[model samples]
Target: MCKDKIAVVLVTFNRLDKLKQAVEYYEQQTYPIQEVVIVDNHSTDGTIQYLKEWVNGKGNFKRKTVLLNENCGGAGGFGAGMDEVLDEVRRHELDADWVAVADDDAFPRKNSFEKIIDYYKSLSDKEQEDISVLCSRVVNCGKTHINHRNRIKQSILRARFMAVPEEEYDKDAFDIDIFSYVGTFIKVNALQKVGTTNRDLFIYGDDQEHSLRLRKVGRMQCVPSSVYDHDRPGLGERKIGWHSYYDSRNHVYILKKYFPIQCLIMRCIKRYILDMSVFSSNTQQERKLFKTAYMDGIKGNLGKNSVYKPGFEITDRKD
Candidate 1:
């Protein structure tokens, strides 16, 4: 064993059972996880109490938590969790080299941590110098690769980001432009340099945005052998709801941040006129929400929307 210390961090709202399962899963990993940081977004359920009790015993991993007063969404929860790890490291409380930012419902397989570390250790010292983020191949329960890894596509006049195809998951090791928070393992030093996920983003696009920042620091390798199972369903289709707002708002921020020229002209003209309104958003209400989203993004007003919100509270049974 390389004996490098790692910490796993995840965000949870009120799904106590799922949270417990996630922690147990991480504990079951072949490679030891030194600590688990649970960021609770003000769960009304007995999550805080559960964690207090969960940490009391003969567990393989030490448990830590960040209990928020209000729901800051996944982006804020994750950012806080990673920042907590970084702070712990700075304080010499957490002797960790890497931190895995994951969702409450997603985690790497039992051997995943071991495989990922082994692959990293296999690389020559020179090869390892350029690699800072080691991402896992995230897959849904269907045993198909989720749209986890992606290569960015953008230019002065246009921008597009699509995940690499399922076949690409077969590659043992390959570089990618982006990785998801579902199971992305990041080097603590690299995260410190790039900073944590944008808290303003609140939810959607936070992972992608943070991944872009991490990419600038060093190479990100996608190792399918380090398989991650995301216990979720396939995204069916767009439903007109609170999520529509965040999806609309953060997208413009990403476009404007990365492709400024394109965002200036294209997002204002093309996306605003076509993709956002006339077609994508069907109802007048949907259009209104999207319009607010676009305006917020344009004015650099990013954060949890006062009107638009996340619909995750009534969560549990695979819906």
Candidate 2:
């Protein structure tokens, strides 16, 4: 028997088209979701209208939307969404035993949630007691694609730990130290203990930090039977553009919070070398932003985003 109903919280910004596709896919889940809570990070691209219309047109599942006033990035969006659902659960208004986190571009396989529930139900009570989060095998949306960004193999060196690669998808489920938010299944009990995602990190590495925080209370694993397709291409060495600031800054916070001193030092050296090596046409601007992120991170200054762009915040649902 399923002990608790599943609630999914998805965070979205300006990607209305992708978000629409994701919602349609989720609405068709074979196992059926109890509720879907969407956190819109102030989207100006008529996402609010789309969601309102979708909710009105669909009556099979409970849907809720939270409209933020500004662009809080993925970290803040997830934090806000999770806290809202947790509040409903605490108030006895929503009987959600497990909460799943997803990106707006993540489309799950029809049987994915079913597979997760089955694997979770197969675990012994003692085994279940030790597990906190269950991650899904995430792959690119096209044929013959391997997604290295979704999985990780823990190591002393930050480079090794952060970018652990799996060449292909596996059929078995196993424990893992790190994962992304593409399709992260977390237990309500664990949240009650470890708390929610960090809102301050704002964007990059927040998922990593949250996973580490969850580890302090329980274990995490990847359920290979469950899978999702992310509407993203395989990534290479990314240029330091607008994304570089958050990537550089939040990484520092993650290292400071979790890594040992020796590991931290080695990671710093390796990271510095890699950062310095990756330069393109906009090398000077990239270097300046990178240095700024590094210094801010070192100072532990996690203020509001100085570089974030907000989306439109509005309501179309009159009810």
lDDT string, candidate 2, 52-96, tens digits:
776666655788888899888888999998998899999998888
lDDT of 2 at 279: 37
Provide the lowest-lDDT 10-residue window in model 1: 310-319
Model 1 Cα lDDT, one tens digit per residue, 1-319: 2246889888998888888788878878989888988899999889989877776766788888888989998888998999999999999998898898888888678998998889999888777767779988887876766567888777777777777777777777888887888778898888879899899888888988998888898899888888878888768874666787787788888877876665456766875666456566345665666788788977889887767767622122121
Steric clash count of candidate 2? 3
Candidate 2 weakest ten by summed lDDT: 310-319
**Pairs with backbone N, CA or C atoms under 3 Å apart (clashes), candidate 2:** 42-311, 43-312, 44-312
* Per-model CA lDDT versus the true structure: 0.80, 0.76
